[model samples]
Target: MENKKRIPNWLKIIALLIFIIGGYFGWTAYTTFLASNVTDNQKYLYINTGDTYLQVLQKIKDQKIVEDPNSFDRAAKYQNYTESVKPGRYALTPGMNNRRFIGNLRGGYQDAVKFRFENIRLKENFAGKLAENFEADSITFLKLLNDENLAKSYGFTKDNFIAMFIPNTYELYWNTAPEKLFARFHDEWKKFWTKDRLAKAKAINLTPQEVSSLAAIVKGEALHKDEMPAIAGLYLNRLQKGMLLQADPTVIFATQDFTIRRVLNKHLRTDNPYNTYIYKGLPPGPIMMPSIVAIDAVLNYKHHDYIYMCAKEDFSGYHAFATNVAEHQINARKFQKALDERNIKK
Candidate 1:
């Protein structure tokens, strides 16, 4: 009987202590963490070139953006976001707890579709690749290029369509609209042909299309930036004298190879319009996606009266410009000697 009575008093004391402890914890939790309410306001967070987690936290706090970076980071750590932040723009929002925020930062978010072009060869190939990545009708894109009756929707010509695609990296939404994609390429092409570029082309009496063509030629010849102006000058001189450009890249574009053994009679027979060796002035359109540097080289080609040039044997990415056929022959012999020494099959 005495033991049972003693047990009740001790149980009462333990219950009272438990109630006091629970109250303390509840009060602190309410004051510290639960005081602020999470709203649905939009916010933005930036990750700079080289930033650490602590630095990012400080930035977040200093900007008065997120009130509790520790909790955010703690949740990030729980979700293993030690290095989840990517370098670019992101649209953020409030009411996103640390877990959801970190999850998104770690690429648990909507992915932006990607388009890339490095060294693609033809328009058909381009259409096919676009079809593969972007869910656009590849057959339709091909039909558009081929002038088939199935799809006559595209506004640009086959040649103009190829010219419009800027060869570079692009980020777009997943499953893009066809009209928007077409409009984007055309818009980008027009923007690239800015007012400054037009004025320069006007000075030379070259049309926008002609300048675009010249830019492509300049790109093909000068494999190195240092030789751009020199290569441009040689072609400009050829154009002025009404002489054939005789550029090997044009032939290579036709033959689709660097191997010709020589610029033989047969290689010239391949009838691709890019063959400047057989045909006149410039190719019908831009052969490759011209770089800004190549465009500038054509615009500001040296005023020198150089008429011929051959590759420098040193492969210093510079060429030996010649004023006449004799000097060009000498340089040409030197290049041939180097080729022979290396047993270059081309």
Candidate 2:
């Protein structure tokens, strides 16, 4: 009389299966959106130019930054990131979820690279350094630097183009093209040559390029910043009196052999535009990438009547200045004797 209808066991089994499936889907959604899916290590991802979306995903997988690649792929797909790939250097921190990772790549937010160059002595070396930092190759950068037409478009000759790059720490993007890199350098040069700087250059009766040429010599001569102004002033004196610059640094550059520690008589006889000893004016280009300190020292050179300079006999990276040939000869003799004593015959 009280036989109640029992629920079917199959129905209960089916309901339990539905609950389990729903829980699994919910967990996947959470991991894809809100849960942390990356491993516990900070990493960096560089998406270079011409990299495809699949290649980028493969790179991420190779880095093992994400704990769940499936979720990340799904999230990236959902965000439509595959349609627009951006190239940049992205930093991947620990515990990053798929949403955060995909959002960063989609937004095209990248980090800046710190680039610095000093004592760069050749255009090839400069090109290689730039290639190491940017997306462009060394050959491409060198081509642009050596191209007469391209350099003229920027108000420079292939000879004096080195003056455009001021040696200082610059913040640049990793994927910057060769022309964009040149544009940035040109902009920096323009900013450096402010009205006040131009006035100072005018006061000295030297253009910016001429000042750079002299500054390069001063930089090559003096190792200490404290003596640059004095060296610059001495060279200015030489230029004012229409004397040969006779800068030993120019001889070393003209030889194209930086191994020459001492500029010998033969080195000075090199017949090149860069040989200030043979020529009567500044070299056609900078001997090295001059620093800002050297450039400014030239602009604010010490007012002295000394027209000749020889490195000190002590080898302490300082120099001796003389206003007359007799004093210069005496200083030169002392330095020569010191070199002889050290057996430094170039």
Model 1 misplacement above 4 A: 1-109, 114-116, 137-140, 145-156, 258-262
lDDT of 2 by residue, 167-253 (tens): 989999989888888999999999999999999999999999888988999999999999999999999988989999999999989
Q: Rate the local accuracy (lDDT) of all candidates.
A: 0.69, 0.89
Q: For candidate 2, what is the total of clashing residue pairs?
A: 0
lDDT of 1: 0.69
Give Cα distance to truth, residue 241, candidate 1, Å: 1.7
Please give the distance, in angstroms, between residue 325's alpha carbon in candidate 1 and its true position after superposition.
Answer: 0.6
Give all TM-scores, in the order shown.
Answer: 0.63, 0.93
lDDT of the structure predicted as candidate 2: 0.89
Expressed as tens digits, the lDDT of each residue in 303-324 for candidate 1 is: 8888888888887757888898
Question: Given candidate 1, what's the lDDT at residue 92?
Answer: 66
Q: Model 1 Cα displacement at 47 (Å)?
A: 28
Clashing pairs in 2: none
